[model samples]
Target: MDMREFAGSSFITVESLRAGPREEVVVSVAPGKYDKPVATFKSGDQLTLNKTNVRTLIKAYGEDSRDWVGCSIELSIGPTKYDGDQIESVVVKPISPPKPLAARTPVPKPPPPKNDMNDDAAAF
Candidate 1:
């Protein structure tokens, strides 16, 4: 059985930053592979993405786990070196968007047709 599952909370560290009198930000650090948190994949009853995978995803994405909450990273299996030994491992990669989002231009509305106003308009 893998142990990283149980080691999650153990290795993670949380820090609180005061931003205002009543506002604060909490930072949580989890086991990461590259420079990012390892991405966890849940199966029927198993979970994948170990420390290495988390680091790779962190590197592919970013170091801050909060920022990665809604981000996407691609993973692949490849050979990696560890302590002078080569072993197959999962790696995370960043995918570039086809194009950047462009600013939307508002459509010009046609000016109201010119018409004369009659004082009887209030009777309606």
Candidate 2:
């Protein structure tokens, strides 16, 4: 059997969502599965973009899906109602700015080598 049998769904699933939010790099965004726009990740999982996901991605990256490639997004499970039943769904966490680098400690230079020759040496 192939991965499809093991994976069940080629798309990301709520049950597969990690305990903590995980960042995934976008590999490509294109029509997949049912001719709907899907965001494929470097992790090899694909997420079919719903209206909420589409809006979130647009707000984070831009209107152009092409620009979304190579960008990162945090995924988590959130509550949603489907068919009058509460269910967990994959939600894209809001994008946050990268933290600034901490100040580096300056390395001290070594003292210059001492002159080995004595001052009494004859001038040539």
TM-score of 2: 0.60
Best by TM-score: 2
Which segments of model 1 are wrong by more than 4 Å? Answer: 1-38, 41-60, 96-124
The models' CA-based lDDT, in order, is: 0.41, 0.72
True lDDT of residue 101, candidate 2 = 29
Looking at candidate 1, the ten consecutive residues that score lowest on lDDT are 12-21
Clash numbers, per candidate: 12, 0
Candidate that would win on lDDT: 2
Model 1 lDDT at residue 37: 38
Query: Each model's TM-score, in the order given?
Result: 0.35, 0.60
Which TM-score value belongs to model 1? 0.35
Model 1 C-alpha lDDT per residue in residues 7-113, reported as the tens digit of each score = 54322111111221111122333455555433333311111355665565445444445444433444445567778998765444444221212322233578999
lDDT of 1 at 68: 41
